[model samples]
Target: MKKTILLLIIISTIISCKTVKPSAENNVLVLKGTVEKMGMSTFQYGTHLLKTESKTYALKTAIVKLDDYVGKEVSITGSKVEGYPVENGPDLIDVKKIVIK
Candidate 1:
């Protein structure tokens, strides 16, 4: 039937138009921002924050303490721990290297 064929075509078109989210695994991300600590209400410890132009991301670093970078501009290279479309709060990332700017 023509109606059945049209329905199938519409379904295929809709499925093809859907967007897919990028995987964070093994994908290095470079972000520039100021390092700062999240407030007490965040319910997290040993995690800092990178305040960028558009979004603020939670920074998890084991190499260097974030206290030294606080209030200072820095460029960080790391892989994302959490993807965008964060519902509750900022996205999370694991820092690999940091350079003061």
Candidate 2:
């Protein structure tokens, strides 16, 4: 009876455990672009992104809370995080600083 309970507990623990998601917070990148709000719906708030001549990057961290510079051109320093594309999709960045151009 004790062995069965222990096995059940172990199984339950394993089932309850969640897989850790991988992140790209460690890869740093420097970029320059204009800030733009993004989303599909008109009523919902959209995400902020940096638009460059050749690419767009989803900006986070530094600019997530600050919105004074929207639609303005600026240079930013940040890290390349997951979900950003290296060749096609908009790059993802955790912005550290922004310099207006």
Candidate 3:
């Protein structure tokens, strides 16, 4: 009886550990760094910029609705889109939060 109960508990725990998909309500990965460069033209959506590590990324529309957030320290989060940094790009990241830090 004890072994059976233990087995059931383990199985339940494992099943409950599945990863949840990022959603608009809770789909923001916090990022901290100085904004290396911001997109100047309207072609780029939602303030596209890079981090200190030179990684290119963009904030989702939820955070800020501007194409200028350059040269500033910021903390933001958004759904990670596959292809970004392109003009009029299809890459879309669902932002959850953004904070200047």
| Top lDDT hit | 1
lDDT of 2 by residue, 2-101 (tens): 9999999998787666334444444556787898876553222225778899986776684445386788888888887654554444656777788789
Worst 10 residues of 1 by lDDT: 17-26
lDDT, candidate 2, residue 74? 89
Runs of candidate 3 exceeding 4 Å displacement: 1-27, 36-46, 66-68, 82-92
Q: Residues 8-101, candidate 1, lDDT per residue (tens digit)?
A: 9999887776534455544888899999977764435337889999988888888877788988999999887645425566777788889999
Q: How many backbone clashes does candidate 1 have?
A: 0
Give the winner by TM-score.
1
Cα-based lDDT at residue 59, candidate 2: 65
Each prediction's whole-model lDDT (CA): 0.79, 0.69, 0.59
lDDT of 3 by residue, 1-101 (tens): 99999999998887776444434445446666665434465555645554645455555565564345567777767666656647754345555566676
Q: Which ten residues in a row have the lowest lDDT in candidate 3?
A: 19-28
